[model samples]
Target: MKKKSAVLLVLSVLVIGILSYIGAFGLNVGDYRVKSFSQMLSKGLDLQGGVSVVEEIQGKADNTAIEKTIDLINLRINKLGVSETAVSKEGNNKIRIDVPGKFDKDEVINLIGKTGKLTFKDPNGGIILTGDDVKDASASISQETQKPIINLELKPAGTKKFAAATQKFLGQKITIYMDDQKITDPTVDVAITNGQAIIEGSASLEEAKNRADIIKSGALPVKLKVVQSQIVGASLGADALPKSIFAAEIAIGLIFIFMLLVYRIPGLMANIALVLFIVLVLFIFVTIKATLTLSGIAGLILTIGMAVDANVLIFERFKEELKLGKPVRSAFEAGFHRAMSSIVDSNVTTIITGCVLYALGIGQVKGFALTLVIGVITSMFTAIIVSKHLISWAINIGLINKASHFGVNLRGDNNA
Candidate 1:
């Protein structure tokens, strides 16, 4: 590489590192948020603070029933326009729900815990059908009115019942009730004998979709009773963020000092690559919008340590090559080549374990797994690609050329 190009490359890497840091932490320009990492990262309930509820099945329920209940709850929560909601099985007959962000505690509890129990009733208040009879429901637009509407399909038994009811109640109204609260009552103009029905008068498509989702969730296989409910305070997790950031800063500072003091020039190269690695990993997290939990911070710290270890291995190998009478450039190549296998093996294994954990684990464990996987991938790229180029550029430009500069001892005078 030419001297000018090499110089520009090094400066560019450093500038990118600084900008990445600013972006991850954030910067403000006047009244505008310039580079806000907090906005980009999705905080979990522990970090942002929200309501948590634990509900137990009211009657006989097995694992399958519990899972179905959880699924239904998930649907209801999602329909409420909340993201980053967590619904997980607690034990044999219990499920836990966590919702992030501030909300009305009572309203949220009522919304989630309500059995929904949508029922169709005649004008005389006689039951016609229940939500369980419906097979599927979705939202769409009405071709005639150009307004949002809900489409519902019934199961075979529901179809027969609804057909008979519509035939009997023609020119009359059939009321739809959710938890005994009247939702919509439309006149049966004709007999809907094809197992399909359309609900009109929705204000918007989103409202239509929400109604459909609520109706579908109302068909959950089991009833749930709230056993525990609380609004978690963010003070604990909020305080943890700064402390963890401080610790991470100290860790990086100490690692940089140790590397620079021990390996001299190569250590400086590794430190630069480490900065790039940190930036890349954080950027990836933001891109993927992975929730950053405390366990995720732990995984990040571990990955940083492992990244430094990769550099140590390569630098040691480089020193050995130098001691064997190899020149600076040759020793750099030989070091990276020799260290490649070990780095690949270790990182590959770590990634595999992370994938396994992510697949089988839940909640915080999955958070740890996600960060671990991203960290390992970025660490390898930093070690092999970023470090290699920077170190080779330094030697090529004569910025580092002496054996002493590499922390290698001179043996017999055979250095070429």
Candidate 2:
């Protein structure tokens, strides 16, 4: 049993050490890659720098209308090829948009908040069809003309209306407009009852695609006015990231030293568990694709302290049991068993607080709460399971048998 425990302890330490190194420095073997936490985790607007805008509905709108407006705005932003953009409804009548990375604020605002009402009109300025009548729009190169064009698919009603307009105005120009701005004017050639048509005046395929995406996103169900806008500079985020990482490194380093000094062997086990805790939390973040913000880093640092606190409690219990002349194995078991309640109580309360913050808060606060909750739960597992098993294995291997090894001095007693 002692031999088995020694081998297991060594293997566990090796695995944890390797994981910790890889988590910090990443690994690339052939095509398979494992990114470091800094590279794997997504950064929020506050961390990466970007534009954030909030818009308010101008008039009273129902739930369905507000939801539809949000969907349309998200579609518009996505079509703009903005990755990591967040579009969510805030309050009852407001929508918040977060676009990460550097971008022109005005262009983002216009693309996201605009009421893109597309219309087809005759040369006499009479409306022939609205965006609602159009079923789909796509940008492609014309097979015959070899020019950029926007292909339009119309609804049954729009097909009839467009057929009539084309027949009546054959050889005349029919204009298409988006938000009163003219897009294309094509002369009717052969008018038929087909539901398909093409607009062909784009100078480039990129412009054609932009126009098609705008038209395809459809109009917002309700008018919205921009209420707030903020821009974060990329330089600010760039500076903050290194400082935050440095601070975390210093904090964790101090924690590792303190644990090793105060509790000796048990402290060493706790330190190993702490490293595992950090790796597990980071793994969860990467798996869930959670965005890390500045506030989120604060939460992570705070939980590191909490994770140490659990080990402190368990080690103290172990020392108490040793002073009572309990065998090393019994004392180890008693330590974890007695500390379990306190650990669960503290961690559960913290998790509840994190839940409340996540439910009530927005933006950075939400990020903080999410990180805190994940850290707390992961810390609980490390302290209760990983740390317990590590110390148990060390004790079983006869590496830890005396009370002095746990910083406990039973001078008058033979327990040592």
Candidate 3:
């Protein structure tokens, strides 16, 4: 392909990607996008300004319980169709849940606050008590129906109690209940003196599986204290978007035009790479389901500035090569190879900081770190692979014949 054509194709792919994101194009590879880059990244409650909940897990919070609560948070977030919502430990005994976008917050709070009581009943819809009494519960697939179901092995107390309950309800319908709600009612054709049981509800696979998970995870260990609640009016978000767009466009446009005028051709190439850097980052965020927030947007902007750092380094080296009277292609290669050390050194430090923040930080801090790290890594990729490839292809096709044009001097090139 001609150099211009190749670059155009890549750019077109990028434009389509953005269009898809804003709903201008109607194309869905499907949920989870096992293969495509459309990750189910949703926002955290903090960014979009939803409910901020503080639950006090008082007096001896179990590690097991904390882990289970995290799992439950994930489950509920998934149910809400918000992807990878943040639920993390705050201090020692507090767990903070941030759900992105507005949700049925009260309903969710109730579901999360309950003890996650699980029960089993005979087909007769009679009560067969299960232990909180539930030693442990799991989600599995029924072999006959090939669908998801909940599996429970009652504790000895629960075992004996369940056995007794099952025998009394023998040859009748027994149903499983979680906090007084029937989960599944399985008929007992014979006595189940043993302590094993399965509950399958005729529902969609995802619904059954999620319900089973909710029941298995049990209730949140501590009663949640609504420490704070903030609602971001939709009007505010609408107002901010145009300004954000204006800022992004101005920043990007200036960088591109400056690259062409100052660094010349290679600078233009770097600018192109920078644009790719942004595209790749957004693409990944969508694929991973990273929710954009005010803070997240700031992180992205900073990341964009940082992305140019690597390219600036590369272009400087390329200029040095050109001034030294070496081949353009070789200079491009050397520029990238030699500048790599500085690039690695700088980004590695940022990444380390990101890791530290992610480990110790909660809420928006983590989101910033995540996006920052992702941006740096992808910027490096585009710099090394995407940027250089474009430059080399252009050279091969004779698009840039002179060093000055590729450097800080060009004719009719208004792009910085």
Candidate 4:
């Protein structure tokens, strides 16, 4: 039964793999050969020809921070109901954003382009400050009233500035600005000594909740100017997917073969993990309706390589376990456990990179970064969970004998 379950799992993964390659578009296996590579998948802005918008990020440049801004921009594009949008940042203070053509180009622009504006005001109501000076924002409640509010903390300089503003505007409005646009206007009743402030103007339950979250997530530190914007046409996706997939396939193939040759049995499991990793990642992308921009495709390919690297780590550890003459199951388990540390450390580091790219990178690079992050996460799952399940299954099926566990050989390779 255990072997059967594992076989079923492998079969299920195989079906998913075939489907992903074919995509959601109606597939006639007979007609599959006749279809152009373009028909197999969607295109991004660069390929389809859509609008690209470049903007200036406006302050404090950490490569990491800038990358995160880029990721956020891509998220906005995703919300606009388009897939394959490109969003990234330029130099120290600018963002480059793009997406494919749409009938409502203006709407897409508005959706992807706005800076998050969140505000708060004093009860007496006179202007104080906005999200611009906030060093951080988070969800909390007023100490006195215990009502939900977004806590806003200003930068050191911003703190002094906000304190002064609150002192002067006591009994007045302190509106939050997102891209110089007002979000919430909370009232300030007294001078605030702490850098902390609260935003109290959510119009609805959901709105308030969202405002609280935005505050917690922290708003864009500075104002951004949209330097450029354009809607790309549909033709781009057709052109891009083929090239992207071709690159990804070649890379994955090379990695698979390399693993098999270098590590033997363990390498085979890693390769299987890699394929499952790809399937899960793409499945998430399509389900999430992520816009598949050119940079996004590039990110996906990059993740493919990383996923294989994760497998390699595990397989290498398996070698250590085998050399110790541990039983097959014990060796497999030990190797997986040992490899887990490397896999996690590497993936976490990459995730941080992705987060930065998402934050400040903007446009297509942002897309790539977001996809890369997602792919990394999904890779971890397939590598740790899916791969283990497969190996355990093989052992259960009597695929490996007592001698086979240590100096073994098998017919065909799982990854191949």
Look at candidate 1 and tell me the lDDT of residue 285: 85
lDDT of 3 by residue, 1-416 (tens): 57575676467547645644544223446562333332233544533445555677756867887777778766755665655466778888777776656555686566556666666655555555654666666777789878877676677777787777767777667666666766566666565556677766647766666666665665565445555444544555566756775788888888788778877766767776776677678778886767776667778888888887777888888778767666666776777789999999999999999889878887778888888889888887877777777676667666665677665443432221
> Which runs in model 4 stand beyond 4 Å of their true positions?
1-42, 53-99, 102-241, 263-266, 402-416
Show pairs that collide, candidate 2.
none
lDDT of each: 0.83, 0.87, 0.68, 0.66
TM-score of each predicted structure versus truth: 0.75, 0.77, 0.80, 0.54
Candidate 3, residue 234: lDDT: 50
Task: Tell me the TM-score of model 1.
Answer: 0.75
Across residues 26-66, which tens digit of lDDT does each residue of candidate 4 receive? 45666455332344345566666767667776656677777
C-alpha RMSD for every candidate: 5.0, 6.8, 4.9, 10.8
Question: Between candidates 1 and 4, which one is better according to TM-score?
Answer: 1
- Regions of model 3 farther than 4 Å from truth: 1-41, 73-85, 103-112, 121-126, 164-172, 222-226, 229-232, 409-416
Candidate 4 TM-score to native: 0.54
Instruction: Encode model 1's per-residue lDDT on 351-415: one tens digit a residue.
Output: 99999998878778988999999999999888888888788777777767878777766754333
lDDT measured at residue 300 in model 4 versus the true structure, 0 to 100:
82
Error of 2 at 348 (Å): 1.0
- Top-lDDT candidate index: 2
How would you encode candidate 2's per-residue C-alpha lDDT over 199-317 as one tens digit per residue?
88899998898778767766888988989999988887899989998999999999999988889988999999999999999999999988888998999999999999999999999
